[model samples]
Target chain A: DVKVTQSSRYLVKRTGEKVFLECVQDMDHENMFWYRQDPGLGLRLIYFSYDVKMKEKGDIPEGYSVSREKKERFSLILESASTNQTSMYLCASSLTGSIEQFFGPGTRLTVL
Target chain B: SQQGEEDPQALSIQEGENATMNCSYKTSINNLQWYRQNSGRGLVHLILIRSNEREKHSGRLRVTLDTSKKSSSLLITASRAADTASYFCATDRGGYQKVTFGTGTKLQVIP
Candidate 1:
């Protein structure tokens, strides 16, 4: 069984403030992804990392950025948090490509 | 962008009854997978069927894929209360790292 540990299960940040959401996976997966899910809109990808320090933008990456400083850890950063950035953020990792992705519990963020 | 199009966005079934979900997609794929997600939680992998395969089963869950039609279906036999969740179909594109997901079908199993 793979365990994806997210630093926070719930978060609240004020507008214009910088926010960081951290995720770590015990399994050494080559690919990691960040997604924000909204009600009725489904899951929209933010950013993904294929290897250390390597990244790519996904479907919705306008207000977010990511950092993969190490193999087991991936972080999502909101340069300037806005009310629109509030949503359920999910982290997932996989061996590569579209193979089964092991997902984190999720972090519910509320931007004031 | 590639997407897995799912039909019957929502369903309600009685306990002990069977439930079925369908998925359709465009473009070629290497494999198709099913997933389950509870309210406010991350998704759990249910089953995976490759393009070459027509049908596969795991426990009470059955999945079928029709490449000629570019579609697939999932059947949950004798569903229980715990089986109630949002079901999604994901397609593994021929590319190494492009996997797209469907909008999902919300299944409610009434007791």
Candidate 2:
């Protein structure tokens, strides 16, 4: 079975603290994406990487960054945790030229 | 930013009834896909219909795509309580491997 594992299922952080949410996929997919899901807003893409060391900003890339140093691992970074930044973060991986994407369970982050 | 909007933000139905949700997108797409998310879990891809295809089915799930109207719909036949979840429509614009997701329709199947 294809699997995508996240570093944490829940996290709490203080304001101004740095946060890291890690995702690893066993599928060895070429494309990785990071998204923040909020109520009514849906899943807003933060960043995506099609290849190692390459990243593209999505519609809601502000306040967030991503790192894909390896094929199976993709990490999302929050430079400064703010109350507004608290949301469910999801990571997904898909093969190149494929329409289907496998998503991780997700990390619910809380900024206090 | 969301590219698609699903109509009827919430829907309630009996276990044996069918549930249908519609999605309308702004731009032309290479393909459209439907996904289901149970509660706080991540989305699971239900079906994918390319721009050239009109209707497609997988098991009890049927998806229809109309490129002319830039819209799509998903129908779940004889939905059970296990089918209760938020359904979303995602559009792939072809390049960059990026797809935009809609707000999603919250479905409730009461037994």
Candidate 3:
């Protein structure tokens, strides 16, 4: 069984604050992704990393960035949080050639 | 941009009944996968059907894909109370190493 863990299940921050969400996967997957799920928008990809120090912008990457300093850890950073950035953040990882992804418990962020 | 869109934003069915959901995509895909997400939780992989295959089954879940129409359907047989959750369809567009997910259909099973 693969385990994906997030640093926080729930987080709250004020506007213009810097926020960091961390994700760790035990499966040693090569691909990692970050997404924000909204009510009607579904899951919008924020960023994805295929390897350490490598990141690609997803459909909705504005105001967000990512870091993959280590193979097992990925982090999502909000330069300056805004109310519009508040949403459920989900982290997922998959192998290089495998399309099946394992997701970590989401972090529901509230930007006041 | 979301690659897939699921039909019927919400569905309600009685326990022991069957529930079906549909998903439509815009482009060619290497594979389509279904995921179940409990409220406020991460998604769990349900099944994956490759483009070369038309139908696939796992336990009580049956997934069908139509490449010509770029559509897919998921059928849950003998639905149970624990089956109440949101179902999402994801599409992998080959080498991107990531998939795009649909809005999801929220299913509620009445006991």
Candidate 4:
């Protein structure tokens, strides 16, 4: 089974605080992605990594960054949490060049 | 800019009825996929239709794609209360596996 796990289901942060969201997938897939879901706006990709140490910016990568130091783990970093960055964050992984992505449960972050 | 746009931002239906949703994109795609997400949960992949294929089915779910029109539709037959969730359409524009997702359609199935 493809299992994707996130470090937290819910997180609260104060403005200007740095935040780190961790995701680990057991599928050993070559591609990993980070996305944020907002009400009415749906899910927008923040960043993705095709291989270890490789990353690409997605549609909404302004306030976020990502890391893939290992094949099974991916991390999303918020330089400084802001109210506008409060949303449901999701992580996903897929086999090389495959379209079907397995997703993690998600982390709901609240910034105040 | 080229993203899938799902029609009917919200829908309400009774259990055992059929619900259909449409999606339109602005560019050519290698494949189109449908997914369901329960409130506060991750998305569940439902189906995928290739650009060369016109239609595909998975149990109670049916998906149709029109590459010429850059549109697709997902139909759920005999929907149940468990089917109440948000549905999204994603398009793979055929290169490095970058997929763009649509806003989504919120479905409410009253049992």
Candidate order by decreasing lDDT = 3, 2, 4, 1
Evaluated against the true chain A, what TM-score does chain A of model 3 have?
Answer: 0.98
- Judging by DockQ, tell me the better candidate of 2 and 3: 3
State which candidate has the highest lDDT. Answer: 3
Give a tens-digit lDDT track for model 4, residues A29-91.
999999999887878999999999999999889988888999999999999999999999999
The TM-score measured for candidate 2 stands at: 0.99
Off by over 4 Å in 3: none
| Local accuracy of candidate 1 as per-residue lDDT tens digits, A34-73 | 9887766667788888899999998889988899999999
Q: Give one digit per residue, the lDDT tens place, for model 2 in A56-86.
A: 9998898988898999999999998899999
Q: Per-residue CA lDDT of candidate 4, range B25-87, in tens?
A: 997788999999998999999999999999999999999998888899999999999999999
- Candidate 2 docks at the CAPRI level of high
List where candidate 1 sits over 4 angstroms from the true fold: none
Q: What lDDT does candidate 4 reach at residue A40?
A: 78
Q: State residue B102's C-alpha deviation in candidate 3, in Å.
A: 0.5
Per-residue lDDT tens digits of candidate 1, residues B1-111? 437877789999999999999999998899999999998899889999998999999999999999999999999999999999999898876644646788889999999
DockQ (Cα-based) per candidate? Answer: 0.56, 0.81, 0.86, 0.76
Best by DockQ: 3
Encode model 3's per-residue lDDT on B10-97: one tens digit a residue.
Answer: 9999999999999999999999999999999999999999999999999999999999999999999999999999999999888757
Candidate 3: which docking quality band? high
What C-alpha lDDT, on a 0 to 100 scale, does residue A97 get in candidate 3? 89
Q: Alpha-carbon error at A23 in model 1, in Å?
A: 0.8
